[model samples]
Target: MSHARRLQRELQKMHQDVPVPGITMVNTENFTQWQMDIEVLDQNPIYHGKTFRLNFKFTENYPIEAPEVMFVRAIDREIPMHPHIYSNGVICLDLLSSGNGWSPVQSVESVCMSIQSMLTGNTKNERPRGDEQFVLGAGRSPRHIRFVYDDPTV
Candidate 1:
């Protein structure tokens, strides 16, 4: 199916099915870009009671290519504290990487759940090493940066 059709189907399914816990679609006004709010449901102290916003940008090659996913700062939302999450909202999860882990079968819901899990399993209260230098030099889009997925333990 075309990318638009695939996205439409996913959107419809998200609306029709029971919503995933701790994951809520905040905005999906168009096919290209979407937003979601996610909370770490467990008692992870660093993320307790905090809601983080995620922004997904889809290209024409979506599904075939992974959508760009990142945490975004917004009203009442703060980026969760994780070693893999940058202060500027760039996420370093392999699930968002096309080369390391992304697959066409993954959907928005799955991505959110994966992130929620990533946060819940974390005990770190620090950002990635060299986060400041990286964020300053990084491109506006995560797709442009080749992230090294070296650490598996969050």
Candidate 2:
């Protein structure tokens, strides 16, 4: 099946595993884009309890070009601290970035799990290096910010 259909099927199965209120999506006119939210459930530090809405925009070159994702809720969505995450939830994880790591063999489920793990592991309140300026500038807008992946371990 094409990757788009595959994603639709996978997302269907994922919904079965997640019954949380905020986690859902609907394909746009362009099947490459989706609107979804991730409700945090892990018991952790700093981000113990929060629901974050994220937009996932896949390119025709998906798997090759990692899906473009961004935070949706501006006020409550404070970027969680992590080595691979920018101040605006633009994740820099190798599994989701361009050349540093991601491969076509990886599935959408793995990506979701990685994001869950990343959030659960965070405990700091700071942004990646100089993300303060980035955040204040144009980090909130997805189309404007492009993440450059430098490190994998966060």
Task: Judging by TM-score against the true structure, name the best candidate.
Answer: 1
TM-score of each: 0.95, 0.69
- What is each predicted model's overall lDDT from 0 to 1? 0.89, 0.62
Clashing pairs in 2: none
Best by lDDT: 1
Candidate 1's error at 51, in angstroms?
0.6
List RMSD in Å for every model shown.
1.3, 4.1
Worst 10 residues of 1 by lDDT: 138-147
Q: What tens digits encode model 1's per-residue C-alpha lDDT throughout 45-154? A: 89888899999999999988999999988889888788998888899888888785899999989999999998888888999999999889877678767788788676
Per-residue alpha-carbon lDDT of candidate 2 for residues 92-113, written as tens digits (9 for 90 to 100):
6666656556777665556655
Number of clashing pairs, model 1? 0
The whole-model C-alpha lDDT of candidate 1 against the native structure comes to: 0.89
